[model samples]
Target: MLTVLMLGDSLVEWGDWPSLLPEVAVINRGIAGEMTEELSARLMDEIDACPDPDAVLIQSGTNNLLFGYILFPTMLITMLQRLRLCYPSVPLIVNSLMPMPIVAPHDLEQINRELAVAAAATENCHFLDTVGPFQEQCLPITHPGFLNDQVHLSTRGYQVWAATIKGLLEQLFPGKLPG
Candidate 1:
């Protein structure tokens, strides 16, 4: 069976991947209002539960950037490095943080985008750009079709996510769920 460990804050939990992916084991480790430090602290438990995940989808750090002083890019790199060290062979897919119109383009969302781009340059880490669908015609937007909050996603929001992941399935695992 294909197993995937997903870790993040509420944004990660918003997707109904569990019900949507019955064929695959989707372990969601999303805790509302969590920061990168909190996630890093819980790394051991997550890794323990995800002993052999075919892939790991990470959608975190919005809370961190919104609340903490750590640079978003550095926090992302830290998370990726830690996860990579835990399971070097596991396919790592870092889901980009959603867009927030209330927060300026230069704030958390922008930092998150930069982090995604930076992660894309590294090995074994696929940085998925979230701004693509969550935005309105290439601009920052907060529509019910995309987000429940500045960061969280509604059902429609998850639809966009599902579409993105579906396209990546072929490359992440031929004829298999990307998780």
Candidate 2:
């Protein structure tokens, strides 16, 4: 079975990916209220433990923005570089920051753009633009019952997220999942 390591903050911590992608084994290393710097510090050890993941999924930086840090792009890039150093060949899927009710759409858009560009520029890395789909459910004006709170996803949200990433995973590593 394919093993995917997911690392991030509360959004990732609350997800139940094993249930969502039954074909693959998911190792979640998410910690609630974790900032980018903290995640960076723990990343090398986490990757060392996994050592051979088919892919790594990350969705951090929200807390950095929430805590009033202006260095999100730099921090995120550093984290990606660290991951690359640890697992040079493993595919890294960088999911865009989910839309939050409190953060301005324009500001969030900028951060997502920065992350997308960085991921695209990195070797063996790809950006998963989840903002639009998530906005369809999480945005206050377009809420479709996917998010429990303004920040965290509900069960339905996790389902959506899983489906979205599954498609990309299949594309990136076709036939890796067994029946």
Candidate 3:
């Protein structure tokens, strides 16, 4: 099974990754309410714990937004640089901030734009933009993607996220991952 090291905040921590991606070995290093700066600070330790992962996926910055740090990509870019140094040949997947009721759409768009740019500039890095997929999947009022807190994801939301990850992994690894 392909091993993926996932790092970030609650989104990564709370996910039932083993069940979500049954075919892969997921090493989740997520801390709830963690900010970009905090993640950067402990990033090395996290990577050290999982010395030889096939890939790394990061989904941070939402907590930073809650703390009113709009331009989080600056710190995120720095963190990505460090990650590249640690895992030069491994594929790095950077997840865009999901659209939430708390953040304005424009601000989310701007943040995702910067994230996309950062991923594009990094070698072997891939960007996963979830805004459109989430929006499309949660169109029905009864099937809202977010939990009651309007920040965390609901089951439907996770399905969308998992599907997206699976698709990307398939592309990155070809037939290595089960369909």
Query: What lDDT does the true structure give each of the candidates?
Result: 0.71, 0.82, 0.91
RMSD of each: 3.3, 2.1, 0.9
User: Looking at model 1, which ten-residue stretch has the lowest summed lDDT?
Assistant: 137-146
Clashing pairs in 3: none
TM-score of 1: 0.82
* lDDT-best of 2 and 3: 3
Q: How far out, in Å, is residue 105 in model 1?
A: 1.8
Over the stretch 24-138, how does candidate 2's per-residue lDDT look in tens digits? Answer: 8889889999988889889888977998898999989888877778477787788888889888999999988877767788888888889998898789999998877775645
Top candidate on TM-score is 3
lDDT per residue for candidate 3 within 1-179, as digits (tens), equals: 99999999999999999888998899989999999889999999998899999999999999998788877798888888988999999999999999898889988898999999999989999999999899988854788889988899988888899889988999999989975
Ranking by lDDT: 3, 2, 1
Which residue segments of model 3 deviate by more than 4 Å? none
Q: Residue 23 in candidate 2 has what lDDT?
A: 87
Error of 3 at 19 (Å): 1.1
**How do these models rank on TM-score, best leading?**
3, 2, 1
Q: For model 1, how does the per-residue alpha-carbon lDDT over 109-176 read when each residue is reduced to its tens digit?
A: 56766776767765788877767666643333433644535556666667676666656645778777
The TM-score of candidate 2 is: 0.90
Which residue runs of candidate 2 sit more than 4 Å off their true CA positions?
A: 136-148
